[model samples]
Target chain A: MSSDGCSSPSGPRAAVGDRVVPGPGRAPAGTRQPLVRFDSVWKTYRTGAEPVHALRGVSVSVMPGEYISIIGPSGSGKSTFMHILGCLDTPTSGRYSLAGTDVSSMGEVELAEVRNRRIGFVFQQFHLLARLSAWRNVELPLIYAGVPRHERRVRAMAALEQVGLANRVEHRPNQLSGGQQQRVAVARALVTEPDLLLADEPTGNLDSRSSADVLAMLDELHRSGRTIVLITHEPDVAQAAERVKRFRDGRFIDDGGEGR
Target chain B: MSWWETMRSGFDAILGHRLRSGLTVLGILIGIAAVILTVGLGEGATAQVNSAINSLGTNLLIVSPGSSSTGLVRGGFGTASTLTYANALALGNKRDCPDVAAVAPQVQTGGNLVAGTTNWSTQVIGSTPNWLQVRGRSMAIGSFFTASQVKTDANVVVLGSTTAQELGLFNPVGQTIEVGTVPFTVIGVLKSAGTSSSSTNQDDMAVVPVTTAQELLTGTPTVSNIYLEATSASTMGAAGTEVTDELLALHGITDPANQDFTITSQTSLVQTASSVNSALTFLLAGIAAISLLVGGIGVMNIMLVSVTERVREIGLRKALGATPAMVRRQFLVEASVLGLTGGIGGAALGLVAAVVVPHFVSNQIAISVPATLGSVAVAMVIGVVFGVYPASRAARLAPIEALRSE
Candidate 1:
């Protein structure tokens, strides 16, 4: 099944998997704004004499609580999309906003606050600091959010429990298996209760079994009403998502429509 | 994070490379310790000079005769015999010299002092009864000769502690000591006065009435020195002028330049002693400043290396929501910790050296609280100033580029 961006009068629920429940569903885009929007966004890197465009004229929308996958090979702008979406980088041209707030023109201090309060990130490398234990790593985003230490610990422990790593709270990243490390990363991303969760090649370094386990965990999080953007190149990994958007060069192939 | 938490992490980062951190601290430590020790040494020298001047008695002046030349050979000062004992008495009159509080005129001679079978060579000084008060000396045994003793030219002597000890007299009072051909009874022993500026020991000479010494000992009425104590500290200049004028008039030298005497105040003596030590202190302080600069450079070098090595870590922290200011603060804390440790360690080491060094060296090592505290403060500043460049470098790192760095 495919749901194009223009055909999203489906209360934003028809765009996801089959766990849709009957409730006071979300208003249409005509009434409520999309959680994330990108209009003709561009990203360029000036490494030497010439400028390199990592993202070019890309446009998309992600409704609240929608679990979406962005699939593209290396140099296909998927990483750039995740970076811009997470407020880690600003667009060179065009406009990009999260939850109706424009962040492209934000200063470093403001951008850091946005990243801390509004976005959660999980990297392919499982970028957990080696010096910290699982709970300490999970509590990092909350630390930036200025949460009290006691509350940060409690919420971090709760996040670890949700990821089924409560027993490994004090264990360091090196002490855990690859799948456990990815799970810990997932816990860290969810600890801040962010508006958006971005996972960049989260299973890229995991074995097949670990990859499937992480995907299943992400599927569970999606069902429980968490917004997630999974960036990857593997078709099988993209298959785990209810909706997928493909990218080529710096623009989205699914600009106006979506297909599998 | 709270400041304490941030500082703890900074401390952890510094500790990650123990040997490098320690070497950097050592550089600063050496500088701080040297400054403290040098300051103490300079202070000790100043204190020694002040005490030496103080021992000469406050607001006092000494008038010594000009050197006498004999066939191109000039005798030392006080050998001219230009000042007579009568000149001393004339100056001592309150009506003639109102500013002059007291005067002690003495005739000095060296002889083998004989007490029984024991004999010791010492300078025998002949002075009036006012000599004890004028020289700020007190008697340890019996008492000094009275004005009556000087009036009768009594054959009495007051032996110095060292001279009496040399002559093997435990209680020399009432004992007999022969000075040249004269036999004098020791009426008292003078309290020890240690040593002056040179090899002459003040505690190693004997004192007798000027009349007794002049009539039976030197057989001369000339005075070698006239020690004048002004009525008060403020009247020393007035007393000096009065003495010079009176001496010139008495010696029949109308021109002031041809006067046969020289007056040196205790203030001048103090100034001469301090000038030499001041030069040494200045050189030592200069060296200390250079060492501090070198130490500051060492701190900068180590901090730069730390910033470079932790690029990825910095990126991670930035991504986790650390602002540039927070990152800079972290590095600054690390740098300051290094400096503070060095300062505290150096101060402790300097204090220890101050206590221990005096045992081996003849010079006193004065411990100064302000100097110690000031050195530590300077060490802290050195750390902070040197830390700025590296900390700013760390703060400027872009999160994306830093994270992507291998």
Candidate 2:
């Protein structure tokens, strides 16, 4: 993993509009570029007799190990932005690259491979299959990755341990509490060792205590040098990230906030 | 996913909805059972016909009067009185028809048999002493009439077992019976031959001398038919041809199509019976196949509903990195398993029915192995063919749209 703005735990954060320089690391120059780069991406939906512009010329970049939050009310294009970032939908125009590979024009099969190997998504609904246990849910991505069964089980157990759900590996999603289900989803997201973690309203269905626990888990992951992108409408959730980007009417607006 | 894992998931899905899956299987089961029963009864009928024909006599040939055409309308077999005792005599000449072993000339007429106070209508067959040899029959009491009796035109007769029984005479030899007011003495009794495959009772007639039948009963020299037995089964074909040629020469018939006589071998009779049986079998199978088609549609309908109900699950799997091909494979395997299971169950049921039916019905039920195997294969094909559209529909679902479904 590469270190950027989030390397120092107690130092004063860089001001807004300041470019994040590479921190002291052993990575070569070729690998120190931003992990995510989107140059004026656009998305248009034509579902209901007219074209709906879900995204319009949105441009952004994020360095490695940075925790960025995209906050917007409903119908503000935040979900569309998360979809594009998670590789679930393709951008209509402009360049979108992840880990140096341009993915804007990729086909469905290639995009699926990218989502399986490079990106992990945490949806608001948890999305755990009701039939499978927590460990089996975590093992799903590795199963698609063609990993051996024994090794997939081992890595799934390790991920469950990371989310503090080590004792609940055999419990199904319905048997677990809302906070525990969210933790299982997190473990599932991390099991593939993806380069980017995309959390979309991770605390939307949880109580305050579970939401606090989930936010604290994301903060810990960011501190441990993982790239995290959080999408939420809650101010407290946005405050946990090092930077916040505001959106309204299908375009990004200036939130004007530095790391706190 | 590995093939083992795919199969496991498919079986689990089938097991999850027990009632739905069972009903689907039942449809296929009924189809397969119908196929088995139809084929089994057809095969049994064919075997019964074959055995009946075989029991008549392996190397016997029957020479009957051929059709007679009058302008546009033509008559069927035994319509023309072309066969005669002269033809039998000429065929019996070993130097002329070396393939023939024995010959019997028959003259048949129906009349009431009178014995004391009992009276019954029965066919009286007039033949020579060689009738028993050519027909592969034996006397159960007393002895067969000698050739001397036929030559002398004696009024002695041999009674069939059923004829004797109906006359209330267990020991009918030397007893006198009236045939159209002519009293004839019974000399022997033939053993019962049971009912033929064509459903004709072969034991309800009496035998007499052809000479007596012609001069006294019918007052004509014409005989109804002639039966010839070959020296061996292998010579039956040649014996039939020889009889045809000899009869045509004796009648001075030059054109082959205008022949006065028809010579038929036992093998040809068996062949005709089996061909008719096979045609009936095909007709029955065609009717049964309609049910199989309906069963396939049932599978398709159920699978389509399953796909619709599990749209969100499909989306979840896709988002979890499952390929479209994998989704299709899982559903296809599930449908095939249902078909195969139903096929096995139906075959077992059909076999049990075949075994148990003989006690209640006279029709034989034969379970042919090839037909059973063929039904099983067709059932599996039905499943795979019907499953394609539903599985492809599931595979084509968009991940985002499917996940959006509740």
Candidate 3:
């Protein structure tokens, strides 16, 4: 056992080769439990009778107010990992704790509660209800969270305002520009003030200019103490995050030789 | 949000597709109208029949000379003439039959009623004072003939409204009207009793004393029919039975089958007519219900298409934290809106049909608004019932998969 609480670089921490270690200097200032933790998580899907392992013995931890990026190629299990972190799917064999609660053992209803109350998801498609106005789309999370009508309206409006979409609140997805629509999605994600904001290729469908705009907004959200986990196949998008974990063949590979 | 707001939001969604919603509602409207119109026509016809029967007389029985089956196949009068003056008198004298209010013998004869230059063919009936009370016919102008006039074979006469109008006798009270060659004085004119299309003779009729009618026309004292009145409405059936038994005994007939005269009551005739009307109404309603079923099926089909089209919307809502119940409620609200709007339109159409059709075809047709409302309610139920499956299917869709779809 080590005398200090921090694991030594030459000790058992070195045995797990190529695993990015957390830097001692980057430890959170305040004492708070990790918002997300995955222990020996294994996810398998049956393509016909043969089981294909998507994630094998993957362990990870995410603290509050941390901006992380998950980078991978096609079929590298990054999407599956995003699904697990967003509470949209449970790991087949692992203890997955979210917001200090072991969600791997939670029932469907509890998982839905977690998804509703703690996790906000943004998809590459912008996933805004096409029939609803930007404001109504943002209010969707509050509706799920059972927020009162007046407060929900206020919070949704404020979220839209935060995303600088105050004037486009009444515009539907088709009526708004691609960048504006993504901002509306962002507003929706932040409306409930969830513990985690998960974005998966959020700017994949946007042009470079719109992509930079969305990336800047994400960066601002990170600086404002929002915990964001974004997934992307592009290195430029991943570089915008404080930390990037590269996934390949169901395993994490360190590229910059830095801690998580 | 309040439940009302939720409902209102659902309503807004339904209204968003105005044309589709209107078309779906049209199906329900037609269904409700069919049910209401069919039921209304049947009920109206029944009411007309009952009124027609009652117009004949309250205590009157139509004793045709033959039985229905015998007349239908044999094409002649059946074997039985138990109806006589003596039988009428015996029924009137029965102490045990308190229901026997009065009895009057009647004989019908067709003749030309002539007054001055006007001449009209009319049915001349010979009846006593009891006929007026039993038949529910009273003198509108002059008084009906007294019992003495019937016994003495006097030439007093009463004229029906049509008969008086045809003869150009506006107020010919105490005026003599010649029937064939016999001169009879019209002592009274009857009030207008509306005639049914089924029976044309009801409008054209004349009444005279029984003896005078027998002596002038048939040249015999025998009567053709007997009209009887019950003491009260409640004892009509008892009165009919007593009159039948007394007539049978007086004619020395042992078997009821052997008797000639038919004893009928207004209550029985009215009851029979009402039952027939009920059956007709059921048949009409049944036929209409088939159309309603088709309309309901149309609603279901449209709703299914709507659900499929709105799959993406449903998915996004679910992804945003809408429970399955909320999704179901939204669809249900949409369906109910369709049904409700359709019901209103159908009811309006039916009302127009009820009002307009009667004027063009006949004035007797009646439309009941409550019946229309009932149909509307039924249409709404059909909409809800048909909408459930499609709504549930939309609600049960997986949020992620739905959102992923284009």
Best by lDDT: 2
For model 2 chain B, give the 10-residue run with minimal summed lDDT: B193-202
In the predicted model 3, the residue pairs found to clash are B57-B135, B80-B260
TM-score of every model versus the real structure? 0.87, 0.80, 0.88
Look at candidate 2 and give me any clashing residue pairs.
none
Task: Residues A150-215, candidate 3: write the lDDT tens digits.
Answer: 898899899999999889889989999999999999999988888999999988999999999999
**Chain A only: TM-score per candidate:** 0.87, 0.88, 0.88
Q: What is the interface RMSD of each candidate, in Å?
A: 1.5, 1.4, 2.4
Per-candidate DockQ values are 0.50, 0.44, 0.36
Over B1-406, each residue of candidate 3 has an lDDT whose tens digit, in order, gives: 3466567766777777788777777778888888778877887787788788878776565554444234445333534443556556667785956787877777877888889888998788988888888787777788999988877989988988888888888778988889888899889988877767665556579998887887888776667777777777787777777766766676666878756566667777788888988887898889788888888888888889988887877776665667777778778777776777778788888888887887776535568867887887887788788889988898777666576678
Q: What DockQ class does candidate 3 belong to?
A: acceptable
Residue-level lDDT of model 1, residues A1-260, one tens digit each, is 12232222333332223222221232343434567777678899998899999988776777777777888889887778777887878999867768877787898999888888888888887878787899988997787677888999999999999999989999999999999999998999899888888888889999999999999998999899888888999988987876777888998776422212
Q: On a 0 to 100 scale, what is the lDDT of residue A97 in model 3?
A: 75
- In order, candidate lDDTs are 0.83, 0.84, 0.77
Relative to the real complex, the DockQ score for model 2 comes to 0.44
Evaluated on the second chain alone, the candidates' TM-scores are 0.92, 0.85, 0.91
Clashing pairs in 1: none
Candidate 2 stretches with Cα past 4 Å from truth are A1-31, A46-50, A161-170, A223-225, A255-260, B66-76, B79-82, B98-101, B106-198, B201-224, B230-241, B248-261
Judge candidate 1 against the unseen true structure and give its global Cα lDDT, from 0 to 1. 0.83
